[model samples]
Target: MTVTAESALAGVQRIIATYAQNIDAGNTDVVADLFTEDGVAEIEGQDTFEGRETIRKVYGQFSPQTPQLHLVGNTVLTSEPGEEVTATSNLVFFARGEEGWGIQLVGTYEDTAVLVDGEWKFRRRVTKFL
Candidate 1:
């Protein structure tokens, strides 16, 4: 299957949307599945997690007990050579608190994605606080 620029962009956008949905649902296992085996998630002011196990652990920290919401927007995707793609997006997080819901953090994610077995998976995601 030939992956065109438009198709690649759409695929990446779907990945991002699914990522947010899984995270919000606290589906850590499914969230980890979105990454490559050696995928890395680097968060500003936090320890970087590498590998699916570590990624699962990071997501586990924010469990269903801690109801949260993830809002992603302003996504820009670029198709690279050799089935590689890069994307950047704005992220806003909200958590349930005594005052109902409140913003927890705002950040941007710089993502490196690659096609693995005909599927796009995250290779690396560097998250920076705004």
Candidate 2:
């Protein structure tokens, strides 16, 4: 109802939108930019990646490799307060390559969003393989 709450919600929306941008455009920088200077991305069966640099490399690996499309919906949980926000949702991703435009992966985005310079960004996230 307050400005902070609205900003926080907007930030959450941005984070989720960025996920779509990252996969569709292969722009990992946008993905990492969703986070702060010190951000973490934890994927299953992989060690946690600390900071944006590691995130860049990881995105590079994914971008060049997979023809991907990430469709995210159904926010199951969310937290607020402009400086801190978190959202959990089901992300249905589609991919194309050898298979050509079929369902690729179904997963969840556990996002930790933070506000910096009055703009919200993701401080960390766990891309849970489900």
Top model by lDDT, which number? 1
lDDT of each: 0.86, 0.76
At residue 38, candidate 1 shows an lDDT of 95
Which 10 consecutive positions of candidate 1 have the poorest summed lDDT?
76-85
lDDT score for residue 125 of model 2:
83
- Summarize candidate 2's per-residue lDDT along 1-130 as a digit string, tens digits: 3446666666687678876876588887787777788999898777788888888787777774666778887764366464677778788878787757888678888888876777777688888877
Clashing pairs in 1: none
How much is 92 displaced in model 1, in angstroms? 0.9
Report the Cα lDDT for residue 82, model 1: 46
Which residue pairs come into collision in candidate 2?
A: none
TM-score of 1: 0.91
